[model samples]
Target: MHAGRRFTLTEILVWTRREILVLFGLSLVPTVLYAGLGWHWLGMPWVPIALVGTATAFVVGFKNNATYSRLWEARQVWGSIVNTSRSWAVFVRDWVGSAPPTGPGFLDARQQLIYRHVAWLTALRFQLRESRAWEHMHEPANVEYARNYRIAERETILAEELAPYLTPAEAAYVLGKKNRATHLLALQSQQLKELLDHDHLNNLLHLQLVPLLVNLYEQLGRCERLKNFPYPRQFATLNLLFVRLFAGLVPFGLLPEFEKLGAHFVWLTIPFSMLVAWIFLAMEKAGETAENPFEGGPNDVPITALSRNIEIDLRELLDELTIPAALQAENNILL
Candidate 1:
């Protein structure tokens, strides 16, 4: 989400301003009390302060490294998603072999299959995000639970994507649940089976499609990984506590050394606490948000936008034009 750029000053201030005020208020009272007790009583301790700073740095560094690992992993999985999508499109085009326009040939078959493929990607994206309602996702994703799925639409799309790719007798090999991609493929395989039954296709087409099934399985694994593998909660909670502790201690450490005799210079502790508190807290909050990249944060990827692009890519193969514009988020923090 941050890409190569660090956060701006404005972003930090806005995110941490409230906590800064609270830290300032909490520290001001102690600073004034300590000052009222005078320099004689308020003996400064630098050792503890140094230890706290060291601890703060260590924790920050460790947590940051772990958080970025998660971000990078999510990005890598999506990269595979992009690659597999292109591969699928290419496979469809080749498999269909350009049925004649008016003679139940390639183009018509390709059109049907491409739309279903695009729809599956869209559904899968929303399902990964948990963004849309369950029922709403069925048609687009093509993998609706039986109770949730409508039969007519599922059959239609299945027939379209597989029609050009599979032979009729091979299509009859369809079995089991009406999964969108699987159903289409099984039917296509049935067509191949039929061709084999009729001496049309040999075992070569079967061999070619086996790898495609393996790739689909890999994509499914990737989807499962993103949805399930969140950062450990205990680690995130501990780091959060550590950041707060660091923020709170900054004032006590500096108040004695920085205090001036003129006026109520003790107030410096408030701003000092505010400043350090803001920096550490903002960083901690940001790190937390980014670790779970799919849950809809300001800095999270625009999955919907990406899905639409996928849809458009698939449709362009058929010359359709109902596609939407690329929506860009301001400040590079896409939701």
Candidate 2:
């Protein structure tokens, strides 16, 4: 979602200030220490230092590559969200356009479905980002503004301690279903069909709209995968430990060259060791952050902004007078 301009050095520092500081402590101190040792006691084997440095560069590169892979994959999922949203919009406009006046409440039904679809985009975005504070984004959040709104229903499997006080339910039934999204889809489609049967809409409109419902399901499946799956914690942890171990070994490895550079070699070893460690750790953190795009990290796609955009687009499509402000930006960063 970072567009218009690349981040400034200041902005990068602002976003990653804490992480950078931690990496400096973890990686820089060791490298500088060993660089000094290499200069003073093992100057003859610059060859081996160069090789280790080369291998360190490769490790950093691998980390960068892995982080980018997670980022790109997350973007791909969001891309599908955008396209699917547009698809639903097209169906909505068409569905509403096809109906005549007072035709079995076709107009209301389509609007309900469309507005709910807009909401679906919002909830899906929030759910992915773990920003769904239920009272704020759910309970009253109308996933559907029009007749065919598809809100995600929290499927009820059983009753809780205060379940009986809330509403009427056969507790003995032992299970309940509240599929917000799928239920909306089925409800709207069924309502649309009933209206169509009454000559509320033509075949083409219904046919076109039905497919979008299925598309919504597919997108839901994808989001579920993204929300639950994460990068292997062990691999990342091991690499970090391995990097630290190599840094610790550097001092001993350079003992033979300690004569010429004397104490000055410490300065050289410190920076070298730390620089590589920072790169590795920074990238490892990047992957961890990218692994869950829903967490609202800097690297995450702006799901909140995306939800706002969907709201905007739906409002525009409806030609409503009460369009709200566009998604806010942090100077340049959009949510």
Candidate 3:
């Protein structure tokens, strides 16, 4: 997500410059038709257009609120992941130990659980980053904005990433599965079961740890629900339609009103109309950008960085000196 205090005006304008140019064209056309071409009859009264604007404002507001809710919920899911992951690390580190001294495999079991949990995070983030048909990542404006930073999932292969955290056989098994994250959790449960069977983990601690696993699954399901489902298309379509309709009608509504003030005042319609149209377009674009929080948008949850942070915390808990560094935001964008 944008880690800066707020987006600079220059950045905002640059992001919307193309649309601003289009708005200028939309505004200039009617002003030219009415003022230059003397097409006095082309101008419409402002009252009906203002009425459309009022309705469009409500729709746009509703869309923004809904989209923001989706974004906030996605962030909250990852927040649960952060908490669950730390708890999992704690349980794995403290709970799994030889009750009556075992072999070389005993300590390795604890390490494996922590590493595999990290692998699960990596896989889930990769899955979430997968492009959806409804996502705005492919849109020109989003694509352009994305160039300022890197998406870690896009830069690396899942297999290569998972390799460090899982054994060859397990990684192969996980890669073979359609839902790698779910299968990884299964593997975690299976390992915990084996630990309990081998007398490495107590029945009491095992029970508690299992609930944490359940929590992880619940959080995963929440993330998947957000990733798989999109805001209703009907509302999205109608919101855009209304915004565009109002933007197009803006100059027509303003030109005649300005002409009444003075001959020169009609020229004011071009700038005023463009300003009004740009505001509506910006609002619509903001909602659209927030619609898919996992699509690697600048305003997204920064799951890649969050996953890395979890890995760092878990590895440090393991007392590993060679742990990877935490990801820093590039260009003030963490993902």
Candidate 4:
């Protein structure tokens, strides 16, 4: 996500430059026709158009509110994952050896459990980063802006990334599965079972740990739901249609209103109308970009950076010396 206080005017203009140009043309065309060609008949009553503008504003507001809800929900799910991950680390470290005569596999089991959880995080973010047909990342403006920062999932290989955390056999098994994150959690359950059988973990601790796995499953499923089910397409389509419709009316609406000031003031339609259209258009664009929170856009949840942080925190809990540094944002974007 954008790490700065707010986007610079330059960045906002750069992102919407193409649309602004279109708005300018839309405004300038009618102004030239009415002012130069004496087509004063093109001017329409402003009251009806003002009603359209008000309706468009309500629609845009609804869209922005819905999209922001999706983003906030995604962030909440990730926050849960962060807490669950730390709890998992603590459980594996402290509770796995409750029985006397902790087996030779004690440390190995702890490391395996924690590292595999990290692997699960890696797999999940990669899955979430996968492109969807409805996402705006495929649009030219979003595609161009993405070059300003890196998407770690796009740059790295998932299997190669999962390699460090899983044993050869476990990695192969998980890679073979269709839902890698779900299977990884299943493996965690199975490992807990094996630990219980060997007395490395007692019944009480195993029962507690199993619920943690379930919580992870719930969080993972939450993220998947947001990823798979897009915001209602009908609402999106209508929102865009209404915004464009009002934008088209803006210049004609302003024409007679400006002409009241003076004949020369009719030329004011170009800039004034363009300004109004751009405001609505920019608001629509902002909602569109934020609607999909996991589509690898700059405005998306910084899952890669969040996953790296969870790893660092979990590893340090294990007293490991080789933990990687937390990820920093590039060009004021964290994803």
Clashes of each: 12, 42, 0, 0
Q: Write the per-residue lDDT of candidate 3 for residues 1-335, one digit (tens) a residue.
A: 99989889988999999989989999888788888989999899999999999999999999999999999999999999999999999988888883432223324888888888999999999999999999988888778889999998999999999988888888889999999999999999988888899888889999999999999999999999999999999999999999999999999999889999998999999999999988999999999989999999999999989999999999999998898888998899997
| Cα RMSD (angstroms) for every candidate in the order listed | 9.0, 9.5, 2.0, 2.2
TM-score of candidate 3 relative to the true fold:
0.97
lDDT digits (tens) for residues 1-335 of candidate 1:
33337767765565556676778776776677677755535435657976876787687777778877766776676667666666666665666444332124334545545544554554444445553231122331123212231222223444454343334433344322334444544444444455455544346754665576467557656655655666666777678788788776777776766665543666676776777767777667666656665555545555655666666666565566765566454455443
Worst 10 residues of 3 by lDDT: 98-107
Q: lDDT tens digits, residues 1-335, model 2?
A: 44447757665455456655655565444444446334333323556655765676576567657757766776677678777777777667765544442223224655655665654554355346454331112211112111121111222222342132121322222123343345445555665787679877678877877787787788777767666665555655665665655555454444334325666554454445445445555555455555555554445567667767776777688777887677665545454
Would you estimate the TM-scores of all the predictions? Answer: 0.70, 0.67, 0.97, 0.97
Model 1 deviation from the true structure expressed as Cα RMSD, one decimal place: 9.0
After superposition, the stretches of candidate 1 with alpha carbons farther than 4 Å from their true spots are 1-8, 36-44, 97-109, 131-206, 260-265, 321-323, 330-332
Cand. 2 TM to true fold: 0.67
Tally clashes: model 2: 42
Candidate 1 vs candidate 4: the lDDT winner is 4
lDDT of candidates 1 onward, in order: 0.56, 0.54, 0.91, 0.92
The Cα error of candidate 2 at residue 249, in Å, is 4.0
lDDT of 4 by residue, 227-275 (tens): 9999999999999999999999999989999999999999999999989
